[model samples]
Target: MTYDILIIGGGINGCAIAREASLLGLKVMLVERDDLAGHTSSASTKLIHGGLRYLEYYDFKLVAEALRERERLVKAAPHIIRPMQFVLPHENAVRPWWMVRIGLYLYDFLGGKMSLPRSRGLRKSDTLYAAPLKHGGSGFVYSDAFVDDSRLTVLNAIDAADNGADVAVGVAVESARREGGIWRATLSDWRTVEARAIVNAAGPWVHQMLGSLGVNASSNVRLVKGSHIVVPKLFEGSHSYILQQPDRRIVFAIPYQGDFTEIGTTDVPVDAPEDARIDDDEIAYLCEAVNRHFTTQITTADVTSTWSGVRPLYDDGASEAKAVTRDYVLELDANGPALLSIFGGKITTARHLAEEAMEKLAPSMGFRAHPVSRARVFPGGAIADFDTFHAQVVATWPFLGEARSLRMAHAYGQMLAEMLGGITDEAALGPNLGGGVTEVEARWLHDREWARTADDVLKRRSKVGLHLSAAETAAFEARWNAMFPREPSYA
Candidate 1:
């Protein structure tokens, strides 16, 4: 059976596109090379921000679009996305105070002000009194949103499936050819499938997909690898800090996972996309940046976890990789049935990108363009008020501790009801999977959400891997494999 649209990648972009297209009465199939969001999507800095620094690059339109989308995501999925405060310490040398004020003013007005609070000024003394910083300086407090990037991608795929789209994880598209005015595609898993229109949303591997189709890509994407490090909690507040390095690049020290602190993101260009990894130099760079402003001295040993992701940036001939555009570029080849290729996009603007892509494809697909935007809600996002939802969840599972119930409700949203099944107490949650992960959550992932391996459950579906010890991970893997054996183990 040929699908109306076949999306390659299964990252946020592909999943978002599939969800929207499927909801619009299109037969869509999304194929992922590995586990969903195994690469760049899961490796993001995990913030759904408007890219306040993009103001420096004169990307007003991009910033405005992202700002709008950020609020939309927070409202739609209050369980996974929440508003976050960021403190930007002002240094006299970085930029003039008036210029900073002007940028913040534009940022506040750009999104049309809904739930997010507007940016506010702060004196060095007053700011430090509330949330103490290591190196004292005047600061400005602004608002942004944080997201569970891995879970968000998975939820999109789940929602697409619920809407009648065929979502395939652990499946790779080997070739895509245009024949008889339709796309003839071969996917590699245990078998292959064919489709009509092919979407190359393969993120970093997009160029390779174009090459396999014998199509010459006009726009080249520069793969830049960004790395992050996690350490023990450094600050006491829910607010995150944006630190300025001597080199002018900024690093974020954000409160993470209730107890840990997440610091990151060094942009280094790479020759090969798959070669993206955290090197010693990059680790040192991140540590040095954090040490420059933080009160607590963090060393290499303080680094509990490290991760890396490759950004598929549209090359603009910029000397600095960090300066490359975060805005997405859509390329459509109108040779036959059309192939829509996505270049650079952030997690915040994924839904907007999908809407824009669908508008471009509508003409070729012989359908009149409709203003069908997915701005309302995604699956598991039916909660109108978070406080009421939290109260209900806690009330229902009185046996489970408040923290655990809150975590599950926040992580799964209305889907948490389905995951809990008829369980009434903590005992029914099954054996502790270490960290806060329970066996019930693992079963939910395996049975419903396409989680096949222990790593898929621990690393992606839940972050138990980060909090678990080596011995605990080994025990959990043994238990997981014994419960559900795979014919071919995930490599």
Candidate 2:
């Protein structure tokens, strides 16, 4: 069966587009070469906020749009997206306090409605007590939101499936061609399938997708590699720190996973987008950035885990990779049949990006642009109040204490009820998979949520891999294989 829309890439952007299109009554099919959110989407800084640094680049429009989306997402998925405070320390060596204060005021006003707290100034004596900076500088606190980026992608895919879209993981688009005024695309999985309109939302490979379609267009993506390191918690509070580097770029040291501190993101140009990896120089750069501001010095030895992703930045002739625009650009070739290629988008703006993409494709899809906002609750985001929802889950599953119940609720949302179907006692939740993760969640992910491999369950669907041992991973892999054999790999 040919689909009205065939989306390539199961990253956040692709999945979000698939969800929106499917909800609009389009027959949609989503294909991903690897695990969903396995690349850039999962490797993000994990903040859903306006890019404050982008303001310096004079990207006020991008920042303003992202701020609106940030508010929408916070309300749409309160369980997963929670408000976070950021402390931007002002050193006399760097910029003045007045400039920083003005920026903060503009940031708060630019976003429109003020669901989050306004920015506030902090005295050096009092602020240093909380942040404990090595430089003992004054600072300002502003609001942003934290997200489980991987889960956000998964939830989008799940919502798309619920809206009657065929969401396929572990599937690759081998080739795409325009034939008979329609896209003739061949997808290879355990088998091959075909489709009509193809969307090239393949993040880093957006250029490659265009090439595969035999379209000659100027290369638009400038691949910039960003890396992150996880360490033990640095400060005592929930507030994160945005430290200014000597080069004028910023680094984030945010609270992660209840017990760890996540710091990162160095912008470096890459010769090969597909070959993006973290090297010693990038790691040293991140460590130096952290050590420069914090009281506790951190080296490579303090890093528990490190990850790298290639940002699909739009080429704008910037001398530095950090200066490249984060705004997405949609390329549509009217001369060729209907092919849409997306470039340079962030997690915070994905929903708005989808809306814009749909607007671009509406004419070709034989439909007019419709106003469909993602401001409403997504699949598991039915609960209006997160605290009340948690109470309900705890009351129902008394065996699962507050902490565990809250974890599952946030991870699964309203789908937590369906995941908990026909299970009451701890034993019914399935075998201890090691870490706090259970077999029930793993099975639900496999059977219902399109999770196919051990990594999909451990690394992407749930972050249990961060806490599990090497031996435990091996054991879980064995069990996963016994239950579901790896299909022939694609792409």
Candidate 3:
């Protein structure tokens, strides 16, 4: 059957576009070769910030747009997207204290009206947030946000599906050819599907998809590799630390997963998109970056988990990988059937990018220009405020422990009720799949969230993988396979 729009790529951008198009009353089909957010989307810094560092690059417009979206995301999905404060310690040698303060001031101003608190200056010796730093001169605390990056992508896909879009995972578009004024795309399984327009939001593979359609596009995509490492907790507070490096590039040491600290992101160029694995040198670089700032030193041996992703940045003729623009560029080809290609977008600005992309395709697809609902909450994200919602969740499920209840509230939001209804206590929820992950949650993920593998449930859907033992992880995998024996193994 022909669809009004066929979105290629299951990353955050494609899913966001799918949700927007479907809500705007267009028939949309999103097909992914792997799980939703199986790559770059899941490998973000997990922050919904305005890219404060981008101020140095004179990217005020991008920063302002992202700041606006950050607020929207926090309100739309209070469960998954919540406010966070980042502590930026001043170093005497690097950027001046006045410059840091000025940047923070501009960032706050760009944010406009916000639910989060404004940025503020802090004394070095006064607060515990400054205690870990090496001779903290003066520091600034600024508002940003954190997110369950993979879950956000999945929620967008879920929202799209709910709005009558067909979302298919582990499916590929092998080829596409324009025939009789319609673009006919052939899937890997030798099936053909026609669409009025094709959106190439394929992240790193956007150029390759365009090539398959025999469209010669001039926009070059530079593949930049970013890698992160997780270690034992360093700081005491819920607030995160943004440390300046000798190289002028900054690394974030964020409080992660309750027990660990997340530090990362080294920008390096790679030949292919799949070359996202962190090397020994990259791991050492991250550990050294952390050791430079915090009193708590961490070596490679102390590392718990590491992830790497290739950013499909638009080639803007920059001299360095880190210098590439984070802003997205949409290329709409109106020659035959409409083809909208996206490049260089961050998770924070995905929704806005989708809205803009839909506007570009709407004229060709014969759909309304505006999305039906932009502010609708994502699946399980109906909570108005996170704290109030969590209090209600704990009050309703009094049997749940504080830690477990909070985890559930963060993972499922208001949908935790549906997940826990008619079931009381941990026993009725079935066997503990290690950590707080129960058989009930796993089944809900499998049936509702399109979780196809053990990693999908343990790592992407939730961070239970970090809490599980090797034996427990194996057991969880066994149970998962038994539950869905017919599902194709992805890895």
Candidate 4:
């Protein structure tokens, strides 16, 4: 069947666009070469906030759009997106006090009718927050939301599938050409599929995908690598810290997996998207950034895990990688079969970007202009209050422990009932693959969430890998391969 839209790349933008198009009564198909969000989408800072730093570049429009989306996502997916406070320590050596105060005021004003508390100034004597800081200076506390990034992408794909879109994972679009006013795409496995229009939402590989289709476009994407390191918990609070460096860049130290601290993000330039591995210099750099603000000092040895992702920013001739704009640009070529290529979008604004994409391509695909509500809840994301819903889950499942109950509530949300399958005991959960990886949960992700390998289940669908031992992780891989022998392997 010729789908009305064939979306390439199963990252957040592609999945979101697929969901929007499918809901508008268009037959859609989304094909991903690897696991959904196996790249850039999953390796994010995991914050749904207006990029406060972007204000320095006079990017008020981008910040406002992101803030609005942030409010929408927090309400639509309360379980996955939760409000968190960020403590921005004042450094006399970096940004001036007046400048920082003005920026905070603008941030609060732009984020109108926020569900979270407004930004406030904290004195140095506020022991609760200041005790952890090495520098004895006042700071500003602002509100933002955190998200389960990979799961958000998967949920979008799931919603699109539920709306009659065919979701294909581990499928690569090797070549495509305009044939008889249709996109005839040849897959890596040598299968051919036709679609009326093609949406290239391939993150970090947008330029390469267009090259493969023989469409010569002038705009090039600047590949910027952002790396993060997970270390032992540094502070004693649920709130995160945004530390400013003497070099004018900021690093965030957030609470991760309940026990570890997540510190991140160095802006380094790279030649290719595949070269997204963190180096020794980046580790030392992040450690130094944390040491500047926090009382505790860390080195490379304290690093537990590290990850890196390449951002495909639209090349606007910015000298520094950090200065590149985060705003997305949509290029629609209506010369033959419609091809819409997206570049430089963040997780917070993906839904809005998807909505605009459909608006541009609707006429070419022969669909009337149909608008979707930003408040539309994703699959398993219907709970109004997370704490209340989690309490209800614990009440229903008396055998579930506190940690397990909260994990289920956050990961599965309303779908926890179906995942539980009326089972009532830990033994019935079937083989705790160390951490929270039970046979039942593993099978649920494999069959329902398109998780092919142990990594997909342990790392992406659920962060159970952080809790699992090395031996247990290896054992889970062996079991998964032995049971699901028919599917392709994933990294």
| Number of colliding residue pairs in each model | 0, 1, 0, 0
lDDT of each: 0.84, 0.84, 0.88, 0.88
Candidate 1 residue-wise lDDT, 1-491, digit = tens: 68889999889999999988887888999988788888899999999989988989999999999998888898888888889888887752377778888988988988887698889887645654245566575768888988899989988898889889998777787776888778887767645556667889999998988988899889999999999999998878788887767777889988888879999899999988787789999989988887767667889999999889999988888899979999999999889888999998989899899889888898888766554554667668889888899999889888767877777787788987788869987888888766666788878888788887889887787776877899999988888887778755222
Q: Which scores higher on TM-score, 1 or 4?
A: 4
Better of 2 and 3 by lDDT: 3
Residue 6, model 1: lDDT of 93
Off by over 4 Å in 1: 123-131, 489-491
Q: List the residue pairs that clash in candidate 1.
A: none
Q: Rank the candidates by lDDT, best first.
A: 4, 3, 1, 2
Better of 2 and 4 by lDDT: 4
Query: Please, what are the lDDT tens digits per residue for candidate 4 over residues 1-491?
Result: 68888999999999999999888888999999999999999999989989999999999999999999999999888888889989999863488888999999999999988878998898656677788887665889899988999999999988998889998888889889999889898887667889999999898999889999988766778999999999999988788988889889999999998989999889999999998999999999999999888789998999988889998888888999989999989999898999999988999999999999988997776777666858798888888778889999999887778998888889989988888977988889887766767788878888889998888888889898887789988987888887677555331
Query: For candidate 3, what is the TM-score?
Result: 0.96
lDDT, model 3, position 246: 85
Instruction: Give the C-alpha lDDT of model 4.
Output: 0.88
Query: What is candidate 3's local distance difference test score?
Result: 0.88
Candidate 3 regions off by >4 Å?
124-126, 371-373, 486-491
